[model samples]
Target chain A: MNDDVTIATAQQLIEFLGTFAFAISGIRHAAAKHFDWFGGYVCGIAVAIGGGTIRDVMLGATPFWMTNPIYIICTALALCMVILCSKRMERLQNAWFVFDTLGLALFTIAGIQKSLDYGQPFWVAIIMGCITGSAGGVIRDILLNNEPVILRKEIYAMASVAGGFVYWGLSELDVAIQLTALLSFVITCAIRFLAVRYHVSLPQLKTDDEINRVDNG
Target chain B: MNDDVTIATAQQLIEFLGTFAFAISGIRHAAAKHFDWFGGYVCGIAVAIGGGTIRDVMLGATPFWMTNPIYIICTALALCMVILCSKRMERLQNAWFVFDTLGLALFTIAGIQKSLDYGQPFWVAIIMGCITGSAGGVIRDILLNNEPVILRKEIYAMASVAGGFVYWGLSELDVAIQLTALLSFVITCAIRFLAVRYHVSLPQLKTDDEINRVDNG
Candidate 1:
């Protein structure tokens, strides 16, 4: 009589999968920065939950991770995986990047869905999607003492933006929820992968000279 | 009998004052980084609200700035102040530094007060105090592409922690709320000023060698 149990378990599994991938990406960066074990685990958890936390705060909802222990467990597992495979992971340069991109795609879709469920407008949903996909890395980069590459380098947030538009458009066309989510994820990953692979990037703003001149006046 | 109106206005004024100072500091740093007007304004808002946002999220409360428009107005006004006096502010270094220190002190007191209001423990209140004092600068530095100086420099967070302990201790002694807040402010600023005056600083972590050795083994 009820599919709720089955759907809830499936959702939990995907959330855990995404959290683990994000945590691995964070732990790798923390290791690169030579953070102690506890520090590394903290970074892992931060990267795993940062985006969703931001979204939840904006939506006036309790953070998703605080309601469940799965994210924390997944983060610990990710830390262990990284510690055990540090030497080998160092050789597999693309591994964390792939996982990071996949995590971004999944989180973006989930973020947009959550925002929609909150009855937020489409623009807010898109922005929330971008935040979901990219804010984890932004926070991680901050923790690692580096400027977030998203703000300057990668074609990152744009992919999430593009995916948000497609997901919304699909829904407007009466697409089913599962199919719409799948399409959005595929679009996000495809855009991200293609852009990174082809060296596509946004133009860097150059305002030094202009700002200087204005100030001098 | 509804002096709620008068007290609310006074609280709003102080909140705006602190927000303005924080946004000014953030705008100054963004200006040094040569960010465009829009970029600089974004950075300023981020720094102004970042600390309290983190505190509110952890407390499961709505972000303080979101419920009112005053904080946003304060940030915009701060941006305008920086723009109008970019050259003059550069000359009045001591003035801006004083404002920043005052901002830190006030935010620390306010943060601890908020946490206590939420019925959080003393330790959590103390940590939240440090975060409210320092996390804005951390976020600002990250956005500007640098390691947060608070992690290794001066007595920034320590001062907040000390103030938190003092405030909690005084409260335990049944000190009045107003007096406790004022004393905490003075203590935080005194520690920060004394430390800066004497060149006190925490040592940088150097764990790369140990971590590398462990990995090699």
Candidate 2:
């Protein structure tokens, strides 16, 4: 019983960290866009909970943030951090990137586990994982009026997808849940780190003219 | 019972027309952006169902489109119409505008009613109504890499909110549901029409610099 309680506490801690990291990323972007404080706070909350909300809605479950006020508090704290140390935070770009990657990894695993618990098929769970890991940034970009970087050239969603596949494989091989989650998280972070370091990106989709030319030919 | 069936049928018809119009708007925007056929279809689906999906999730209900394939078929038909008659459809811009306005009116009423049915307060319902009427367009703009026009200069969402107020007032006075819906729809459409005709718009939100100056002073 104590072991279960400890595990649950650890999971909650990871969730809080991930939410804070995502919220900070959103507030920084909002600051860059010259949004007011309220706008910054809204963007921060959206980024921190956006992915989980989408995942939960798709899985027909209550959104995790709605059940607890902790996520909101985390976002508020993130906003305060950004407001108080904007210059210092900007200088800690590398630190933020690491935190963001960690958040992505943790959210992906949580999304997969939740979907599976809700009896979704593995494929659907995998998609949910990717959505949980990446959709928040998409929402933030949309709000900031920027094209979603993940939809364009980032290796972001792909890394989440890869991590999901790894999770599925490990679960199939009867791996312990904690070990599987840890391995999946590490793999997701590794892929994101390597992709960014190596400047790897997916090919862009074909434009209308290209599709039309092919059709005519 | 016969009258009730007729009313239900009429409501379903309005929903189909709204879905079709919203899908067409999204597809046309995608085409203008040079997105390929698949991209256009995705945008169409997103715009057609996005708002309702958000509303349903917030209200803790299953998304409406999940239970009915008709919305998908409507979007498909819309895509076909766009593909076959792009030039002719452009010539019918005024007709499309009318259809789009009609859609906005219908969706706002529907959203308000759904929220009320789910036991939400009047204010929450009004917000849901505005979201239903305007959010799909915002999603489409984001997908097309444009700033959401509704956020910039359109009096679109305000019209929906106004209609929701009318609905709430009439409902509180014990008006028939059908009459309430009709009045709300008409009010929404009229506001949209008059606003567009007279160039009405809400003021833009204050930027970071403006807020900072105010704080300092």
Candidate 3:
């Protein structure tokens, strides 16, 4: 019971930090887009919470955020930080990206572990991990009036999938949970960083011909 | 075999019309938000297809749009209509709302029936109906830089839930499929209209301090 309680507490703290990171990333994007402060703050919160909300609904559970106020409080704090530090933040884009990637890695492992706890199959857990980690950012991009960066260009979702698979493989091998989580986070972040550094991208669907035909018509 | 084919054909037509209606609504919202034509069209198409995509993903089935080209074609047509008829379309707001609501009803039943076909229980099917009906609009609203109107004010999701229950109730009574569909559609629309007309709203959750303290802060 004590171990379980400690794990749960750690999970809560991780989720809060992950939410704060996501909110900060979203606020930075909104700042670049010149959105009003209200818009920026709301978008930041949405980016932080949207994926997990969708995941919960899909799992037929009440949204985790609705049950706990910590996510909201953390998002508010993120907003305050953004408002207070916008000038410094504008020069720290590289640092922000690193923070964002770390947040993604942490969230992906959280998702994988949660799905495993729910007794889902490995593939399902991995997919859920991807959803939990990346869907919020996809929603954030869409809300920011852009095609999802993941679909257009990036190793975003792929990173989550890789991390999920790593977690699954570790579990199958009966690895220690802490070791599995740590390794999964490292692998996910590495893949994301490598993809960015190398401009690695999934092939965009071959829609050029279709676009041409439609345009001509 | 022939009868099955005919049923499938009819279902396909309904699905196409529903998709077109949903996409058009999104495009219109994008336009109203002052997005460029391409952006509007893209937003509209995404809104139209997004709910069904989520449903499929959760059900572990191929996404509906990817399974067939009809959805794509319908979105294309919707986009063309919006572009070509932008001026005249301004006068069709009410007409568009009606069609959008019709599409919502159709999609809700589509989702519920599909879930039932997959042998999910009534509660799950009802929830799926709401997700199919409203999630697209929620997505579109968020992307257009707004809190989801449905969540904020409209009795939108409630209408979907009502229609879902209607479907379940009718099915329990061994009602004819067409009649049940019609009843579900009508009931949902009526509820939605009443909600809009009377400004019906759920009580917003507030902190106790907010309730007791005047916003003199």
**Considering every candidate listed, which one attains the maximal lDDT?**
2
Which residue pairs show backbone clashes in model 2? none
User: For candidate 1, what is the DockQ?
Assistant: 0.15
Off by over 4 Å in 1: A1-50, A53-113, A119-127, A139-146, A153-217, B1-8, B31-46, B65-85, B143-145, B193-217
Candidate 2, residues A1-217, lDDT tens digits: the string is 9988997898777778788889988887777766656456657877898999888877777677756678878988988788776655656888878888989999999899999999999999999999998999999988889878888899998999999999999999999988899899999999999999999999888999999999999
Best by DockQ: 1
The sequence of per-residue lDDT tens digits that candidate 3 reaches over residues B1-217 is: 9966986787666666667778888877765555555455546766787787788777766556544566666877887887666556667767767777777788888889888988899999999999988898887876666677887767888899999999999999999987897799789888888877898878887887996786655
The residue pairs in collision within model 3 are: B27-B44
- Chain A only: give the TM-score of model 3: 0.86
lDDT, residue B133, candidate 3: 86
Query: All predictions: root-mean-square deviation over Cα?
Result: 8.3, 7.8, 11.0
Model 1, B61: alpha-carbon shift in Å?
3.2
DockQ of each model vs. true complex:
0.15, 0.11, 0.06
lDDT per model vs. reference: 0.80, 0.85, 0.77
Ranking by TM-score: 1, 2, 3
Candidate no. 3 TM-score: 0.55
Q: Write out fnat for all predictions, comma-separated.
A: 0.21, 0.13, 0.01
Question: lDDT score, residue B171, model 1?
Answer: 90
Error of 3 at B206 (Å): 39
Candidate 3, residue B212: the lDDT equals: 71
